[model samples]
Target: MEIYGCSVTDYSDRYEERLNLYKDKFEDRDESIFLEREMINFKDFHNVLVSIFNCFIKNNDYHKLINDPQFINHLNHLQNNYNDVFKELFQIGPPLLDANKNVSNPDDIKNEDNRGYIFYFDFTKEKVDNLIVSTKRILKYLNNKKLRLQKPRTPESEEEYKGSITTKETKPPKPSKIPAKWHALAYLIELKSKGLKPPINTEGAFIKLELEAIGRIKTGLKGQGFYREVSKHYKDLDKPEILNKSFGKDWKDTILKLFNSNIVLKEYIDKHY
Candidate 1:
């Protein structure tokens, strides 16, 4: 239900129907499953991803999601939904080390418990620790991005008084990243703008093509001959595999590079196109 905001967008009615069917099929049913629960937990993963992107990617804040307790709790909850709950997620207190040894309490002197054996934790903590280190490095980079934490002016300086600006330097608003589901639409728009032949046929066909390409919906409406005419004049028009899976992920980046300097086209893309 809450899938729209994170990554994929512009869901077709048919796709939505398929999504719900899958959801119903998995829920409250005892069946051999490997990745079905993983798919359900995708919603949770996307939630965490969206929040992290907002705090880190959108704002470029020095504090990453790794620093947030709520994020940790959310991730832990998600893990509990599928992970083995018997295992410990973390050890609170630091390991007491007098030397390269496990310091045992002399009062509860148990010979087997005092044995010098080092047991390693599971992959979960390893992943979390890696994330922590990575976030620290990434935050350093974010902080280095042109003095990230700029202080607001209180009109203390003559320049500030003369300018009478209400807030700090406001950069121009960037165009929002177009959704992956709408990549076909955006591609069509771009083609039309450049006076180039449209890919496949109509908008409906392109939408179906995109959904099938990304494994979203499988209606088997194969239009293999749709690109016949287009393919004669150009390469890659006929190949259904031309748009790889990451086509939607980095489609904007790829398309924008072609018209990055074209201000008019860029504005049009940000608005109507």
Candidate 2:
């Protein structure tokens, strides 16, 4: 399954709590955090669909699939035919119902590279069952293959789909996203530069915020005392009215509204420094 594009979120217990935490927090938000989790869940849900379709495709008989060149040829030959049945789905690089597909826009992928992709789709149970039934019908339609491998798929035939989707709608355009992983850090830097507080806390709070910003890509930050001199910093901005006026919506909407924004750590000298 790993070789076949299973993801860390699919297998590991390590990130489960964090992932589920985000799921619960962002459940009602329009933000990508919740949506991406749902999409990944949808992708994983298709494992059963893949298994059933693949079983029939590989072997007409329920219990067995063998290394016969005939079935292999039948699968390869129906490339053009399958696309017809899955007109909308096969058109993009979604991990939708297509057993063989890749990301339409690799850069738009939201997860880390080590984790598999999160593919957004309208994954209602009815839709999936519809696709399963359609695909199965096609497979059954193709089951009476009177001819065997006339010739293996040409290099050109395989290459054709590699470039694009089989449908008329263009691949979904790349969505706008926070430009970098340090989005939390960059936003925090901006907040502190503006002389913000609530931003004010103990040194530990500051360190925790800084870590949230630059988690994997560690860099020196202004050490604790730089920002946590809570006495020096004016703390009135922690009020909801001011927060709503500050960022407009997102920050104030959540319960962690106060310090959920990033924190400060002293800018320590490092090799990069």
Best by TM-score: 2
Residue 231 in candidate 1 has what lDDT?
34
Estimated TM-score per prediction? 0.20, 0.23
Model 1 scores what on Cα lDDT?
A: 0.37
lDDT by residue for model 2 (150-220), tens: 22333566667686645444343342232222234333434455444332245525433322222222222
* CA shift of 194, model 1, Å: 8.1
What's model 2's overall lDDT? 0.35
Off by over 4 Å in 1: 1-118, 122-127, 139-168, 172-187, 191-273
lDDT of 1 by residue, 1-273 (tens): 222221122223233465466446434221112122223344444444344334333322212324455555654554555343212333322232123543333335354543321222223344444444443443343333324323343566776677465654666334345333233333444555565543234442432232232222111222232233223323432333543342544544455664454776676555642
lDDT (0 to 1) per candidate: 0.37, 0.35
Give candidate 1's error at residue 91 in angstroms.
21
Residue 181 local lDDT, model 1: 28
